[model samples]
Target: MNENKLKSLTEALTELASAERYEAELILKADPDTVIAQTVAAVRRSFALDIEKLLTEMGFLDPTTPEKCRQSAEAGT
Candidate 1:
């Protein structure tokens, strides 16, 4: 992967860790169904997507491979 992409992935991972920590803290101090908790969950999900995109761009992840495998399996290939 390029330097910039690697940096981005690292930043995303850091942010995800922070969000997870905050989410855990919130869960311990407040109700899990609270709006803030839900928002943190959403933020975590967004960070996961960002990480996935970076990995895909770095050629570390093949997003289409799973779909292709599924299709081939259905076709008995």
Candidate 2:
């Protein structure tokens, strides 16, 4: 995803988290599995992209070497 979209989504989630909850009784009417899956996907998309972009900029990844990338990850790069 582009940086602008990523930033917008991040801000939106932050605001929503602090806002008062909507009527949970209405949301609870949906399938529990669907709700959980959607929530997980939303969180993962923004968080994963943000971390991946930052790490890539820091040169911790070796594009041509899987082992190098694994080592960097292990070493907490």
Candidate 3:
């Protein structure tokens, strides 16, 4: 995904993590298992891109190996 889309997804995830209980309850009324699995997959994918963007913006990631990129971010944090 592009940086803008990645940032949008990350922001959505942050909002979902803090969603109101009533909204969460309504969402849970659906197929929770499938929803959770899909959410996890999306999160994992978005997390990688977000982390890469964050590291690059912070002048840490080499824009080559993502593993090294994450390590650099963590080291500073």
Candidate 4:
């Protein structure tokens, strides 16, 4: 995977948030869980990580292991 591309998604997400806060509020209020799921899925697919690839990386899903591409986000911190 192109690590730089994955990093770009994060940068884009930040810029999009600043530019479209109202739209984001609507999407979140509609269905919080589904919105979060879709956004994460989009990020993964954006980096070309399909269902099989995602499952393969499931083992590294932990906070202590920061090397994993997928990260757990904490809000209102």
Candidate with top TM-score is 1
Per-residue lDDT over 3-68 for candidate 3, one digit per residue giving the tens place of the 0 to 100 score: 876776567557545554444456568878767666656655666566567666655557667777
> TM per model?
0.49, 0.32, 0.42, 0.27
Tens-digit lDDT string for candidate 2 (5-59): 6676566556544431342333456766568556556555655555555545545
lDDT per residue, candidate 4, 2-77, as tens digits? Answer: 6765665556556555645565567788898869777655544544433233334443234344333335443322
lDDT of model 3, residue 64 = 67
**Best first by lDDT, ranked:** 1, 3, 2, 4
* Cand. 3 TM to true fold: 0.42
- What lDDT does the true structure give each of the candidates? 0.74, 0.56, 0.63, 0.52
Candidate 1 lDDT score relative to the true structure: 0.74
lDDT of candidate 1 over 1-77, digit per residue (tens): 58987787788678767877776777667765666646766767766677677677777789896578779999999
Report clash pairs, candidate 3.
Answer: none
Better of 1 and 4 by TM-score: 1
RMSD of each: 5.3, 8.7, 8.9, 11.4
